[model samples]
Target chain A: MEPGSEREVLTLALGIAIAVVSVVKRHVFRGLPRARRLGIAGASMLVAWTATVLEHLVFFEVLDTVEHLAYFGAALALTSWIVSVPRGFAEPRGPG
Target chain B: MNEALQIAASLVLLVGLVLTPRARTLSVPARVAVAVLFGALFVQQVLDVLERHRVAWADPVGDAIAGAVPFLWGGLLLLMVDRFHTRRLSAQRAQTDSLIDELPAAVAVLDAGARVVRTSAGWRQLFPSAPLDVPLSESVGPLPEALAAALRRTLADELRGAGDAERVPGEDRWWSWVVSSWQDADASGAIVMIQDVTSRVHRETDRESTQRLAIVGELAAGVAHDMNNLLTVLQLHVESMRRRSGSANEASLRSMEEAVQLASEMTHGVLRLAKPGEDEGRAQVALASLVGDTVRLVRSTLLRKYELVLTSTGRPATLDGSATRLQQMLLNLIVNARDAMPEGGRIDVSVVATEDEAQIRVSDRGPGIAPELLPRIFTPFFTTKGAAGTGLGLSVVRGVAEEHGGRIEVSSEPGEGTTFTITLPVGSHARVPQRRAS
Candidate 1:
């Protein structure tokens, strides 16, 4: 296969694997704050995008870093606050 | 800077959407509209990011956050559904608790492990010592083995559905218990209900006993009447024979007299037993002769395996009771002793007259009563001998004893044997009679 084609396939495969794992471990993620988990997912995605950005991997800027952090932070914070519930564990005596 | 401003705008919009008033109370269409509005804002934030930032920041960091907004909305919807479920479950639990608390019967909910979870007010009142989360077996006092076994079976069943009514044995009370399965989508357990059924059971038992006693009384009265007629005929024949012999056969005449007297006593005894409560005929009863006569009658009819022994320490162990009734009581005891030792065992009938009481003890070597069953031995219609027993023998003996201001006591051990003692006030009846040479 071609080098670019292989990289695309690899990226696609990695994304699919991570997505599958995230679905399975949804409970673990639910325990985490939604904002924090979003931040992690966004950071991971950034790393992956940066890998594709070999040509664009020149340097970092303050405006760029803050801007990137803002969107991820708000999304995750909204998600976490919205969801957070638990199920059960217990009993009763005789019928009345 | 443009990306940052867009992110800030998205934050403000997300907060505004979440804090929206009456989201839950809104119509489905309104909820949909609100969700759509939030979606549009999220899309707008991503679009602004793409417009301002390079693909490096936009696709990865910016768009990923924007994409997670829909998921956050999904999570919020799940939270709302979860709250509804919790509210419904709590309402059901409260209703069940209220229903059970107001019930007349004591009810308990047992978990999978047979541990008590929730209990009704009646249950708490009835068995105050039992507390929640304790195993039922541990909380309950010692129950009849059969009942305990049944309760265990109920707990094991997936849909426990069983009920039983049983006497408390030593006590006069009776209780009916029912076990049923209690389960919902979330929880599963056994619901046990206990009702005091003393009055109901007693009413049923009394009806049966009264019916049987009436039948028995009818039969006994007929027999007694026939015996009286026969005795009168015999008396006439003896008188004729006596007149013809002219006092020559004195011994034979005396023997006939004794036989006639014994028959008369038997007739009277039958009549007394036939009557429900006839306490008029009271006299100084010659307990020894009564016992001796009963023994003779029993020996003639008894199985060959039984060896009957009669011991009379004080010959005229009389009591201020009807001689016929005393004889009936003695005969009944002897008969019971004979019945007990079916495999040919020793039966001792002892009449020991003390200063205050005439104590007659009838003991037998046989398979004795069970300790658990011992307390119920005197209960009417409660018998181990299913079809063959009327379960009235002991009850009758107790009644007769109590009628004469006396009591019957029994001591027994399984496989060892049983002994029953009847104590009647000797009083003035202990006087020795003038004896004639035989």
Candidate 2:
């Protein structure tokens, strides 16, 4: 099998695992405090973005500056999620 | 254009979430949903940036990023279920807490191990030192232990029942514990309600004591009636004998007559305690003579320098009541007066008869009762004299006055003296003939 093909299968498996974890621990996520919930969500997004980046890198021999900058934008969103924890989203949960 | 606008709205929302203090109170799940919403929008922009850059190494990597989007949606769905489950449980807890607090019965909800999961306000008050998680035996003592054990056993066996009445050591409460099995969606336990019945036991004991006193009184009155008859016969026989042997051993006859009279008075005193009211026939009593007689009975014992004085007007004054009880009431008053004049004082007993009622006032020149202590003086068994006083003297006086359809009034000054005035209702009865002892 080709190296790129192997990487493709590995990324697919990684994506499937992340999906399973998100489903299983979804209730737990609802109970976490605001800072912690946002932190975990941001961390998970960073992991998913990194996994996708590795998948993108499998076919190319080298990277361009424009793509690096675009990747930097994804990093910036994850950073915002981390630093902005205290005032994260407001909504009312029913009666509980 | 729509995508660009969504990106702008999402960025604005993200700023609000991070900067505002108002967002802190929001529920975790609610906040998670909002965070997930903003996450999805932010990630979309990242994906678009990725696609626009179009690196040749990509092999449909957007699919992996797309995978994360589904999770955000999945987490929100689970959060909704969690919210419903938690909300119902919390509401039930608050509802039970409020209702059990209002109940007079002390209630405790225990887990399978007999640990207190929750308790009512009464339960908290009953065992104020106990914590929510303390064992039932530790909190309420062994009083609740057997009951809790039985309830837990019922749960273990999947049955339902109650426990017998039990007593808590070192406490007077008689507890009757009833437990119902508690099984809900999440857990199983027992709902124990404990009721105190101490007062009921005390009431039953008092009733028995009262009934015994009544029986003893009846027997004494019966004996008195027979004795009165015998005394009457003796009086007749003595009179006949005296006529037959006139002036021979007159002193011996006089002593015999006095002995019989004394026996009659003793029997009447016995009957008085046995019965009250119409059981003894009422008669006209000369008020002034009775007061003089009662005072003379105890005058010698009065502390030195304390004079016993009686005064009355030859008014149409009479008392219609049991003579024995009236005399007893007057004797009690005399004793109370003597005690008041511990150092030396004057006691004046006077009778004033009106058409409606007759008033007798016993005034004493002694250190008067303190104003603050006056109201409690008539309460039974309340005394300032400690071991020297039975405290029933004034209480008996007030009782007798009331039984005769009247009340006693009192007034006093700190250094001056105290006066007790007893008034009795006069029905359509004639005043007794005047008989005053000096």
Determine the C-alpha RMSD for candidate 1 after optimal superposition of all C-alphas.
13.0
Give the total clashing residue pairs for model 2.
Answer: 2
Expressed as tens digits, the lDDT of each residue in B311-340 for candidate 1 is: 999646666666655666777778877778
Error of 1 at B90 (Å): 11
Candidate 1, position B210, lDDT: 73
Please write out the lDDT profile of model 2 over residues B1-438, one tens digit for every residue: 423433454465456345433344445665667566555545554555555568543324544444455456446545644654565567667666777777766888888777888888777777778877767777667655566567767668756666545666666466777877787787887778777765565455446645664676688799899989999999899888899999896899998998898788878767655444325656877677787777876785676678888887646666676677788788877777778888867888988887777788888887889887798788655566876875657877887777777789999998888899998776464333121120
In model 2, what is the error at residue B5, expressed in angstroms?
13
Give each model a TM-score: 0.53, 0.51
Candidate 1, superposed: residue stretches over 4 Å from native? A1-96, B1-206, B212-216, B219-223, B247-257, B276-281, B285-304, B312-318, B352-358, B371-373, B380-390, B428-438
Model 2 DockQ (Cα-based): 0.07
